[model samples]
Target: MNRITTLLILALLVFSCSDSKGNNDTNEKLNALRVELDSLKKSKAEASNASNKQIATFLTFQENNAEEAMNFYVGLFENSRIIDVQRYGKDGPAKEGTIMVATFELNGSKFMCSDSYIKHEWAFTPGVSNMVECKTNDEIEMLFTKLSENGKALMPLDNYGWSTKFAFIEDQFGVSWQLNLK
Candidate 1:
């Protein structure tokens, strides 16, 4: 029924039916079994890879504080951790010790953030924001309080027609977030 059992049965059948002396029929059967085993292994590998793959969101900042933002955001979520970061070298293009690129996982979701060497006129806008679906009131409240610190609250955390508690905030780093109790 299971993969291990099926493989064991196939192995038994292959080895038991094979002869000590090499024969054309036995060689053909062995080759067939080997092919089937290889196919099964490949199929298992593909399935595992598909399930483990994750989609990531990328954010960039012109203020050269990507590391700070990544630390702040990752600290707010549960079961979160910083993965890896690449820093700019002592070059003229980007300042040394600044983040060139950084990757982190917040609540199991992957995120990529970077500091831009060139400044852009356009910064973060309310047109796009990260939406967080929280399970408890405390979660929504904490997220709203932390993310709105030194930033503007687009919508105060309150009851709405759709959710009991909801808030839209632009974080100190100019990233917007919409927190809702689900």
Candidate 2:
């Protein structure tokens, strides 16, 4: 009876040793799954970064004012120019010679503007404004004065706690501006 029990114990030990080696195979599969998951995450991040490159700001203006607004903006910025302008034809919804769509650059930043023939109830509000950073006090002053012409100044140029000079103004075309000196 003792010899039979010893043989059974040896058989169980050999089976357990083989199962431990099987566990190493399971561990290898788990490590491979983890590596695959990491690679998928990296691929997703690269795709997101690529899609973020296509971004621009769009602005809408009243009838016949899109070109005027674009010209005004380009004139204000030193490194600015009108990229393109599309006008309405004689048989169009908008009046002939009026701007249909326009593209302009302001200080090297591109912006799209369009004139809507149909009137909209919504107008430019102070909630969304163009914030400009100026290098000198004179730059802020010049921009504030020009932007405030024929328009109201929401916040006068002054030294706020966070900046040396800051001013909020609504331009002649009702576009809000925040000129900051940095």
Candidate 3:
């Protein structure tokens, strides 16, 4: 009886060895699953990077005299018009010739102008400006130099990441301008 018991113990030890080959198939399957999960993670990261490229950016400005400002701006571009105008007057609102707000388009870009007619001093600052995207270096330089004729230069014409030459200036009438070569 003792001999039989000893032989049984030895057989059990052999079968229960930690380095046995039975787990190899399971390990290979687990490794394959890990590889697949890593591939999926990479694909998701790439997709997120692609989605981050879409950004809609628009510049803003304010003016105390919308009518004359719009008129002066319209003279600079061949194709420009006041798309809409909203006026607030002493009679409450919608008074003719009193422009409270004006929406216009200059060279396919939208611009907004408004008037503060409350007998107070309203002025335009350098904080807001229009960034014009030009086709060539010549165009950029021409616009920058033309706008800088009677104005102060905020940023001198220089090479920037998005253009060959760029400048920001406050025009003669206190309106700001940004010139860039696309």
Candidate 4:
């Protein structure tokens, strides 16, 4: 009887020690998971804050003409200029010196552009267009003429009954524009 009691006490001690070790391992795993979850939440919050700060119109050019188009637009608008441009290197997927990304402003409106290395089946459609409100007749006419050059004019500058002067045109870069004289 004495020997049996001793064996039973030893067995209970062994089982209790193993159970305590298992609990410690589970607790360690849970703490690690909680830390990872907290990190992920912080990263998501930072990204959301950055996105909310500013959102600009992004244009993807397939023909490596982003710089040219940006320059043309900057020249047309009154308070427009190129903010920054990053070009690809000689070992690029696109041609060297082609715009990887470019930021510009057109009459206080922000825009972003990039030269695409991949070919896409879809191009710009007329369903969506940039609408410009011109403050003068000359502004509307001049913009229409310049934008219509080497491009198709969807709606020539006319009364259209809605405004004194309004024109819709697709520029050489295939981007559509709607000019209205206010």
Candidate 5:
């Protein structure tokens, strides 16, 4: 081998080593960037969880006789109260001084209801109704027959294949009800 050839070979090896080192530095920087992005996503998720721990669902009912229905309902439940009461007279088609919305709690379940119209033959249809869940079949049958006492049954109390027991009815006051037992 000649002297020039040896010098050229050494210079090429040095240049290649420098380039590999640069590449390793670049790869390390890229890896750090990726880690930072993942940490940001995790931080965002944790912040959202800290802000709200649970999600709540609320149901609103429109009754023909809010005042009468609310009063009747208040007496039926143990812990029930008319949280907010409003009366509309000469303003809308609501019974003057009647309940606008009877927001109350029944067995710790929050509910809001209002009478949309003052005098109308309209009644609560099965299209919209409150469903009560029973832990046992006996409770289901008891509630079903009791609610059916002065009400009409849309579906008879029986062993519906879908659920262990179930029933549907509209109470005497025209309020629809549903009992589900599984």
Candidate 6:
């Protein structure tokens, strides 16, 4: 009976030690899984942010006048400026010193332009135009006059019922604009 009791006591000690080791292993595995889940969440968030990036308007000119047009546009509106300009070298693709690529902003809207080496039969049409909302009548008038200087005014500034004042003009660069007074 004494030997049997000693054997039972040793058995209990061995079982308890194995059970505690198992618990430790389970805890380590759970912690590893939590870290992996956090890493996956961070990766998904970065990919989502990249996919939601902003889109900018692009213009292609064949006459090597992209730089001129970009500069003129940057000067027209408030809070407008040229972000960058990459000019073509003496290569045969485009004229030397011409704008290979140019980035600019007009009234806080981003725009990109480039002088195309290949000439296409199509040019800018008035079908798609940039719409500007003016805060005052004077502002609309000023923009209309300046934008129509060397260009054609498709619709003169006047009340069109739907709007208090509006004008449609094709700028010298052949880009169309619709100026509306708010």
List lDDT for all candidates, in order.
0.85, 0.79, 0.66, 0.85, 0.64, 0.83
The ten-residue window of minimal lDDT in model 3 covers 55-64
Clashes of each: 0, 0, 0, 0, 0, 0
lDDT digits (tens) for residues 1-182 of candidate 6: 44435545554554455555567665555556556556666767755653564887889998888988898888889989887899889965788888888878788788999999999999999998999999998899999999999999999999999898999999999999999999
Regions more than 4 Å wrong, model 5: 1-64, 74-81, 89-93, 118-123
Residues 1-182 of candidate 1: C-alpha lDDT, one tens digit per residue = 27746766876787787777866786787677777778878878855754585777789889888998999998899978887899989874799988888878888677899899989888888889899999999899899989999998999999977888899999999999999999
lDDT of 6: 0.83
* C-alpha-based local distance difference test score of model 2: 0.79
- Displacement of residue 24 (Cα, Å) in model 5 is 74
Q: What TM-score against the true fold does each predicted structure earn? A: 0.71, 0.69, 0.51, 0.70, 0.52, 0.70
What tens-digit string does per-residue lDDT give for candidate 2 at 1-182? Answer: 44435545554554455555567665565556556556666767755654564655678887568888888889898888787888889999988988888877688666888889989999888899998999887888899989999998999999878887899999999899999998
Clashes of 1: 0
lDDT of 4 by residue, 12-124 (tens): 55445555456766555555655655666676775565457487888899999999999999999898878789999999889999999998889867899999999999888
Q: Write the per-residue lDDT of candidate 5 for residues 122-146, one digit (tens) a residue.
A: 5567888778878777777776776
Residue 158: error of model 3 in Å? 3.8
Q: Which stretches of candidate 1 lie over 4 Å from their true place?
A: 1-54
lDDT of 3 by residue, 61-168 (tens): 234456776777776655676677877766754444567667776774566666554544655677877778778787777777777777788999998777668899
Evaluated against the true structure, the overall lDDT of model 3 is 0.66
lDDT of 6 at 102: 85
Cα RMSD, model 5: 18.1
Candidate whose TM-score is highest: 1
